[model samples]
Target: MKIEIWSDVMCPFCYIGKNNFEQALEKLPFKNEVEIEWKSFQLDPTLDASKPQSTIEYFKEKKGFPAEQASQMIAQVAQMGKGAGIDFNFEKALVINTFAAHKLLHLAKKHGKSSEMEEALFKAHFTDGKNVGDVEELISLAEKTGIDNDEARRALTSDEFNYEINQDIQEAKNNGISSVPFFVLNGKYAVSGAQPAEVFADALQQTYKETASPFKDLSQNGGASCDTDGCSI
Candidate 1:
């Protein structure tokens, strides 16, 4: 089965949904057979890459919530992350443009470490409060994730993966996706929002049965995929 997820790195719910979806995958019997793709979606396209703001202030301004309410909201999200075995430090987070980060993600995908790089970027931005929009910082992150610094720099400066990211965003718009953490299963099933692990698990299993169970014969199709019919013999 193939699962395509459209999300933004700066979006808190995107990371939350990531953790939840990962847990759900772990519970599935065909976890190893599942192919997952992370598509780019920017929440702040107009954000200046040169100067990023602090997470708390950004949240306050965006939500029009008071400081106390914003803090409580962060606390609530942190509590939820704790349950998913993640440590989120919303106090130290940076609110920046995620377009470059998404570009690097496609580069990482070429190196077969897209998911690892994504997790590292999320932690660096949300927990360590690193400036994700900075090229040097991003290069450092890529190097830490086993990608070469030169490759990272090249990707940062080049327009190589920018088109891919834009394509994802455009496709999401075409699919009527107005939110982050949108999951599309086998192009036939879609689940939105940062749902609980159980919810994701249910979606995965249900989609799996809907797509995989009926096509148990693998010899004819050899596991190759189709858009709507899935892999069929």
Candidate 2:
């Protein structure tokens, strides 16, 4: 079974959803058979990476939210994150383009370190307040996640994984996904937003049951010779 999660490092709910889904995985009986793939997403693709701005300012200036309202909003998200074991420092989270981070994620995916890379990126952005768009910082994060530093450097230096990153985004669009923290279970079950762990667990259990071996094809006959209502003789 495959569970693909579309998320952006800048999304507070994405982090919470990740935590919830991981927790859900822990209680799942078929967890070992399930593979979790983290897909790339960018909250603000047009933002200039060179100009660093705090997340608070981004919400205030970019979104045109009042200071008090923005602070309250961040506080609400922070409280939710704390409940899910995340320490979100929205006050200092630097707002920058995540395209490079997403690119590095694809490299990590090749190494089977995509989840690790996602964790490192989220920690760097939400907790340590690092600029995620910087290549040097991304290389360091990749290294921390067990990706070779030199290889990571090369992948970042060149325009690598840009297509994969865009493809993930396009896939999301094709799937009618208009937001981050969207999860697709077995390519059939769609769970949106940062739902509770129980919700995730339920979705997993349901999908597993629906696709379980009990429903396997056991016919001796091939039953594979028909096309356009014409049987292959």
Candidate 3:
């Protein structure tokens, strides 16, 4: 089965969702057979990638929420992350345009290090407070995560693999997805939001069962074809 996830790097819930989904996958009976694909969906694509604003400030300005409210919200998210065995340091978070980050993720996929790169980028932004939007910083982090520095530098500097990033975003929108952490199973079943592990597990199980059987080919049976009437028996 193929599980495609649409997520943004800056989304707090996305990081949590990634952990939650991984936990659920670990418990699945067919976990070994599952293939996961990470897709890009930027929450805010218009923001400048060079600016180094804190996440708190970004939230405050965008949502017009007071500092205390923002802090409380972040604290709640942090608690949730802890439950999933992930650390979230919202205070140290930076507001970044994740376009290049997502592009690099696609590049990492080719080298079989997409997941590692994804987790590293999240940690760099949310935990270590590194500037993920910067090419130099990203290259350094990539090198630390088993990606070759020369390859990383080339990928970052060139526009190669950019179309894949845009294609992911466009595909998500075509599927009526307006949020991050969206999961699509087998190109048929979709579950939105950072749902609990049990919920995801149940859905995956059900979808697997639903498509487990094979049906006879209508063409082999040569059933009556009706195009104009749109009916067959």
Candidate 4:
């Protein structure tokens, strides 16, 4: 089974959703058979990457939220992060354009390290408060995912994988996904938001059941066999 996740690195609930999804998968019998592909979705595609601002400040200024309200909202998200086993430090997080980071994710996908790359990017932005939009920082994160330094640098320096990034964004739009942390299971079932582990597990189970083999043999021991020219009982 294939699971496509549409999320942005800067989205707090995306990280939490990823954690909850993984927790659900860990207890499933067909965990190894599931393939997870992280798709890019930018919450603020026009944000200036060169001038990153504090996440709280961005919420206050851009969203028209008061200082106290912004802090309260962030605190609520941080509490949710804790429930998902994530240490979200929104105070230190910066609101920067993730276009370059998304491009690098496509590059990592080529090396079969997209999942690892996604995790690293989330941690860098939400936990470690690193500048994910920076090429050098992204290269360092890519290196940690087993991507070669030179290859990562080349990919980041050039427009490599930009098309793939745009394609993912367009696909998300085509699917009418207006939110982050959206999950599409087997391209058939859609689960939105950062739901609990039980929700994800139920979705996984239902999708698996629908996609699994339909045959169920009830014959005992050696029963009877029939062929074109011979029959045995």
Candidate 5:
């Protein structure tokens, strides 16, 4: 079974959702049989990478949230994250373009380290308050995930995985997805949101059970066959 997750590095719910999904996979019996693919999705593709802004400021100035209500909204998300074992310091998170980080993810995928890269990026932005849009910051995080630093820099400087990122976005559009942390199981079942662990566990169990096929033995046993007995003497 395959699980594809479309998420943004700066999205708080994406971090929480990742925790929930990981917990679910841990409890699932068929967890070893499942492969997780992290797909790219930018919550703010047009965000200016030159200037940095705090989440509260971005919400109030860019998204038009009232100054007073921004913290409240972020607090609600933080509280929700607590339940999923994520310490989301959204107050310090930066509002910047995630395209470069997404490209690094594509590189990580080729090296079988996509999940590690994803976790590092999320923690870098939401927990440690690192600028994920910055190539140096991204390279540092990539190094921690066992990615080659020089190659990572190359990927960031050049136009690598640009089409891969766009394809993921186009696929999201085709699937009618407009949210971060969106999940698709076997390309058939969809789960959208930072749901609880049990919800994800149930989906995994149900999908694995439903897709299982019955065993069949259609081979012939020759002219004569017997179990621990002589035949056709």
Candidate 6:
């Protein structure tokens, strides 16, 4: 089965959802038959890449949230991250445009390393506090994911994967997906948000059953058959 995940690198819940979803898959019997495709989504595409800011400051100035409220929200998300085994340091996280990073993700997808690239970007933004919009930083992260440095740099420096990124975004919009961390299981069922592992496991099993092959041959002994030789018993 194929699972397409729509997520943003800077979204805390996306990272948490990824971990939880993987945990769910680990308990499944047909885990090896699963294929994951990471789709691109930007929470704030209008964010200026040149001016990086802390999450608190971004919330305060851009989103019009007061300092106290922003801090509280961050605290809540951090606690949730802890439950998912993610050490989210929002204090150091810089909110920057992830368009370039998304392009790099397309490049990674071409090389079958999209999962690795997505994980790296999430950790860089939520844990390591790196500027994901920066070309050099993106190249470095891609390199760690086994993507060639020059190829990564070319992808970032040029507009090669912009169409793929935009297509993913457009597809999400058409599908009425207004949130990150949305999971499409086998293109049959949808699971939204950072749901529990049990939820994912159940969805997987249910989708598998629904989509599994229906034919089953039951033959205990050989029967009479006719071939080029005319007849057999």
TM-score of each: 0.88, 0.91, 0.89, 0.91, 0.90, 0.91
User: Which residue runs does candidate 1 get wrong by more than 4 Å?
Assistant: 215-233
Q: Pick the candidate with the highest lDDT.
A: 6
Mind giving the per-residue lDDT tens digits that candidate 4 earns over 66-95? 999999999999999999999999988978
Q: Write the per-residue lDDT of candidate 6 for residues 123-185, one digit (tens) a residue.
A: 999999999999999989988888889998999999899889999999999999999899999
- What's the lDDT for all of these models? 0.88, 0.89, 0.86, 0.91, 0.90, 0.92
The TM-score between candidate 1 and the true structure equals 0.88
lDDT of 5 by residue, 1-233 (tens): 99999999878899999999999899777889999999989888888877889998999888999977998999999999899898888877888888999999999999999999998988889889999999999999888888889999999999989999999999999989999899999888999999999999999888888778534447665455556666652
Residues 1-233, model 2: lDDT tens digits: 89999999889899999999999899877899999899987878988988889877888889999989988999999999988999999877998888888888899999998888888889999999999989899988987888889999999888888889999999988888899899999898899999999999999998989878537668887675778879874
Q: How displaced is residue 201 in candidate 1, in Å? A: 1.2
The global Cα lDDT (0 to 1) of model 2 is: 0.89
RMSD of 1: 6.4
Clashes of each: 0, 0, 0, 0, 0, 0
Please report, as a residue range, the 10-residue window in candidate 1 with the lowest summed lDDT.
215-224
True-structure Cα RMSD, model 5: 4.6
- Which 10 residues in a row give candidate 2 its minimum summed lDDT? 213-222
Candidate 3 regions off by >4 Å? 214-233
| Order of models, best lDDT first | 6, 4, 5, 2, 1, 3
Model 5 lDDT at residue 57: 90
All candidates: CA RMSD in angstroms? 6.4, 5.1, 5.7, 3.7, 4.6, 3.9
